[model samples]
Target: MSWVHIARKDFADAGRSMMLWALTGLLILAVAGISVIPYLLASDGTTPGFEDGVGFLFSPIGLLIPIIGLVVGYQAIVSERESGSIRFLLGLPNTRRDVVLGKVIGRTGVVAIPTVIGFLVGAAVIVALYEGFAVVDYLGLLAFSLLMGLVYVAIAVGISASVSSRAKALAATLGFFVLFDFLWEFVAMAIYWTVEGSLPGFDGLPAWYLFIVRLSPGQSLSAISLTLIDFVGAEDIDLTAAGRVAGEVPFYLENWFAWVIVTLWIVVPLGIGYVRFKNAVLS
Candidate 1:
């Protein structure tokens, strides 16, 4: 019961943010934006439909949602401490666990609802407007998006709880998000280049390297674009296809291992953060 109230308060706090509304609007616009390309290309009968567009619509999650998570969660704990609310909340019989769980559960629910809505909206739009909508693909995307949100939110919350200053918390959280979500890909590519000769070529690469790429949130999200390519039989159309049909390339994001990695990314960080918060002394 106490947790419920805490969760409610957390939810309400997030609900008042203009950024939250902006995120919702952005999602809607993303869904609508893809409509233009199809509209333009339909004249040649070579373009895909709304279902095909769904992949691109939600593609931003590979980077956007993580940044949102960082921004939303960076202050969750440190801000309360700075304002002297942590002790007061503790006085109300709220344990550190309650505070932590409530905040995570509440905010995760808040962010995830819109993400799911965006997923469903994108899927529905594709199904209604395009002939290429596939149930498997839609389900895959929904599952991936849910896990992605969880990972990002957990990362943010963990950073929030661990830091001492609001400014430091925000900076660290943003740094983590940008570093892991965006920079990691470039790093991976660079590493690939450095070790290219010692490492296996594309044809001979080890399962571990393959696993890393697929497990990467950015990679997984990018791989979702392949769903668009596969469904429309445009596998050869987009640059994303790269060398798949032309060679031995496998669809990395579609692999189950990727989801497992994403799951681990969320679980490991949150677990560590929660344990730390549980032991933290409120000033």
Candidate 2:
């Protein structure tokens, strides 16, 4: 009950944030553009329908939602602490858990709602142009995208709560963003390069290679999106023909497991941060 009030307050407050509005606009524009461009360029036959357009958005959404989630959550606690309003938050009959949970819920809404709406708008465009819509794909994309957003919101809010300063929180969150978003791929590739000589080309790479990619939250989200959305003009999840030929890469490499990975990301960070926030004395 108390968490609801806190979450409601934060949700209402987002209305005044020009930066959020701007980012939201950018997200919408990017999504809509991705959703509509192919139809515009298609010669009325070779091009696919709105379903394909929405599916096309999977990659971009997987990339952009984390940034939006970070923006929404990075300052959840530290900004309030810097402004000394976190004390005010704590003063209002709120426990550390309540504050943390409320912020996570509020920030999740901040990123997820806009994202789902953008995709829905794409669906509308598809319906109008194609005269039919893939409701399952539309809904699944929204559901998974929402889950992905919450996963990152949890991570960002956890970082915010665990840190003592806004700068440190921001740095940590951005570092996390980079770690999952870009660094993980590079690190995996480096490992692959170092070990490639021992194995045959690409297909001969071991299960541990896929394990390293699975370690990243972004990779997990992208992989989850693959399960929900049928992408057009995109190849199968197999990165190489050899991976396809490898005959069931590994259990962790499976699509359904990506959702499990996302769930872990949501829980683990929030748990760590909640413990830290519960123990720390809020000044």
Candidate 3:
């Protein structure tokens, strides 16, 4: 069988995603509470529009998708090694490269498909509450959200490949989730403010501050989604950003390059990990 076969077989491991689904369910509940409950309480007592119901999902809900992705991918290669299954898998004609690639594909499908379904369910709720919306924009949002999840899946799978022990892989994955998702933005802001207080304030802030603010994957995805889809992330600054061309702000601050950053999160991690996994000795 081909790598696709391996992917199908691995995707049968879907029973393991209870934690991811729990988090997603909470996010959907958050979306419902934030978007739907309020709309029902409005003066007209109607559901909010597409942006109101669906847009906020891009923020708190979208931010957590990477965590779901990380959970899905954290055991991709390491679990096999831990169970002594890699030898059985390689007993067939499949190369380690095939196993790696298939795991990426299988796990990406596992994470992404549910993410899209979640968004679709949200979209359906939005439509039920409000007037109909532009389906194109809705689908666009879905696609982008799936892609964003894929980025973190790649990152987590990369981590899974690099560590030899299951404990080490779990520790490394959690550390990554903590550093980038929780700490990085806060640390960046503290430094930014410290610099501002030490200097003249407004004019003292560097031009790159805008870019620095979006260094995390969540921020980058939020910015890019806001840029690409007007109705998806109403609160993201890309919606408020002035000037459409270069010299308006740093290119990194622009949506297109923000997209590149998101893509890099997917590509760079997977590439580096691929090299590591390929070179790894399968004991």
In candidate 3 the C-alpha lDDT for residue 233 amounts to 36
Q: What is the number of residue pairs that collide in model 3?
A: 0
**Runs of candidate 1 exceeding 4 Å displacement:** 44-47, 117-128, 132-136, 189-201, 212-215, 220-254
Worst 10 residues of 2 by lDDT: 236-245
lDDT of 2: 0.77
Clashing pairs in 3: none
Return the TM-score for each candidate structure: 0.76, 0.88, 0.83
Against the reference, the lDDT scores of all candidates come to 0.64, 0.77, 0.71
Give per-residue lDDT, candidate 2, residue 106: 86
Expressed as tens digits, the lDDT of each residue in 65-169 for candidate 3 is 777789889998989988998887888888766777788888888876666656656766777776668687777777776787788888888888787878988
As a whole number from 0 to 100, the lDDT of residue 210 in candidate 3 is 52
Error of 3 at 112 (Å): 2.0
Clashes in each model (backbone N, CA, C under 3 Å)? Answer: 2, 0, 0
Top lDDT hit: 2
Candidate 3 residue-wise lDDT at 26: 58
Order the candidates by lDDT, highest first: 2, 3, 1
Kindly report which residue pairs in candidate 1 clash with one another.
50-126, 51-126
In Å, residue 121's CA in model 2 sits off its true spot by 2.4
